[model samples]
Target: MAQAAAHTDTQQHPIRLYLVVWGWLFILSACSYLVDYFGLAGYPRWSLILLFMMLKAGLIVAVFMHMAWERLALTYAILVPPLVLMVFVGIMVLEANYTLFSRLAFFVAGS
Candidate 1:
């Protein structure tokens, strides 16, 4: 009696929500495939791929993982660290490119 009532009090999402998410996931996947099938090259190709990947990942995390129902602080805790790490990685890549270019320039000039 009490247990049944308590269980019913828990958050319950409709099946339609999951179905819609699944459909979106399928569509996003097809778009991702099309990016490669069309033979897009350079920044545009990689940009589309990454954008689709992030959108799919975001959808999975928010809906499938039940993060959408979680508190804001919890969502931030789970999401922020990875975003910060990605920023740091981008910085490192820029630094590495600059160092490589500088070294090449010095070598060529010296010779």
Candidate 2:
């Protein structure tokens, strides 16, 4: 059985790239704050928040976590589960709403 060798590549990434990513993270964070400060209401606000959150998470995972240089199998292994989880979460939300509505309709409030 052949054992997998680790750390074979000695290629060092540029410091400037990390610094730039850091800057973008800071900027996105500020935007997230501004969204709250401006008091954005309803779905649009949550949509923007989720967008920035995902973007920052992706950036951090891709660069600082070194996932971008990782193997394809490893990359998909790490990323795909969360996508499945997100789908489940959406289904759960819909079920929760339906459950609440059914309960409200089926049972009367005590007077």
Candidate 3:
């Protein structure tokens, strides 16, 4: 098990780093709460919320999950499917908008 021992040593699990990351995560969580308390309106609010969410998720994945030191292939395997799904979700949103507009137009014309 010397190989296993050597492999474990390569990953530096410093308490300080964890503390710092935890502090940042806590701050980000507080900021998200502040945004809701302030009643931010419209796209700007959503943009900020999504940005903060992604940042928090990224930090969790990178640090807590230890994906940062992983191989490129493994990293892409874990990340790419969600990215492709997001692309399809965006496309579906556009199609939904078009369908909604058409239905509203047809009903308006009939009335």
Judged by TM-score, which candidate is best?
A: 1
For residues 1-111, what per-residue lDDT tens digits would candidate 3 score against the true structure? 999998878646889989999999999999888888999989988988899999999999999998897899999999999999999999999999999999999998899
Best by lDDT: 1
- After superposition, the stretches of candidate 2 with alpha carbons farther than 4 Å from their true spots are 1-9, 109-111
- Kindly list the per-residue Cα lDDT of model 1 for residues 1-111, writing each as its tens digit: 999999899777999999999999999999999999999999999999999999999999999999998999999999999999999999999999999999999998899
Those runs of model 1 whose alpha carbons end farther than 4 Å from true positions after fitting are: none
- Model 3 stretches with alpha carbons more than 4 Å out: 1-10, 107-111
Error (Å) of candidate 3 at residue 73 is 0.8
- Among residues 3 or more apart in sequence or in different chains, the pairs in candidate 1 whose N, CA or C atoms overlap within 3 Å are none
How much lDDT does candidate 3 score? 0.93
Candidates sorted by TM-score, descending order? 1, 3, 2
Overall lDDT per candidate, in order of appearance: 0.97, 0.93, 0.93
Better of 2 and 3 by TM-score: 3
